[model samples]
Target: MSEPHAGSCRCGLISAEASRAPFWTSYCHCRDCRKQTGAPVMAFVGFRDEDLTWHGEPRSWRAGGVERRFCGYCGSQIGYSDDRLPGEIYLALGFMDEPERYPPALHAFEARRLPFLHIADDLPRYSGFSVER
Candidate 1:
């Protein structure tokens, strides 16, 4: 079998792997995402929940209608899931072992994007979630 896409928490206390290709990749410009990831734009890779597996004790919490997971020891955000979008998992791109393999297909919450960060790409942009979601 091919090697799965994998990654770990900053301190390596938590790890995750995906056996299947991701469903979607996106850049989220929402303030909630920025606050959670401490970045102007947060890239995310989405996959079917069943295709992904997690290791170690990652703490989870709900905020803004999404359940976010993080390493309790290092406080590094690992990923998030939303009940509204069942059977799907979204991992933080920066935490991915091979992020270059996943490129942002669209921009989410574009209206909330920071002024200083300008991306010239012509990827679809939406004020909220893209129509695909």
Candidate 2:
């Protein structure tokens, strides 16, 4: 049996646990994600609703009509839930322990990727997200 995956906010106020490994992982370069995360690119792990649980109330806000949650005290991003991907929550990979274990398999919104950042990898780059997810 595998152990549940875990993550916590910088201030340790918000914590999360997933009963199973993520089904999808990717890097997003959309403007909304950039602005919200204060990064050129953002990595996320997609977990099913039934497999994930939260331990604290994370502060939430909407941008581009999508809901994102984060720790209010430390501003550590927790994740986002998109209506387009119903029953899935995309959590910020940076907050997870040993994040190297959940490497992103592809890049999303590649057209919007900032010029200053370069992720030289052969991973399939998508102008948008993969349809299968």
Clash pairs (backbone) in predicted model 2: none
Off by more than 4 A, model 2: 131-133
lDDT string for model 2 (15-126, tens) is 9888899998999999888988998899998889898778888999986557999999999998898877788888999878768889999999999999888998999999
C-alpha-based local distance difference test score of model 1:
0.89
- lDDT, candidates in the order shown: 0.89, 0.87
Residue 105 local lDDT, model 1: 97
Q: 1-133, model 1: which lDDT tens digit per residue?
A: 2868998988999998888888889999998889899989999998898997888978999976789988999999888998888898899998898889899999999999999999999999998987354
lDDT of 2 at 108: 93
- Taking all chains together, the TM-score of candidate 1 against the true structure is 0.93
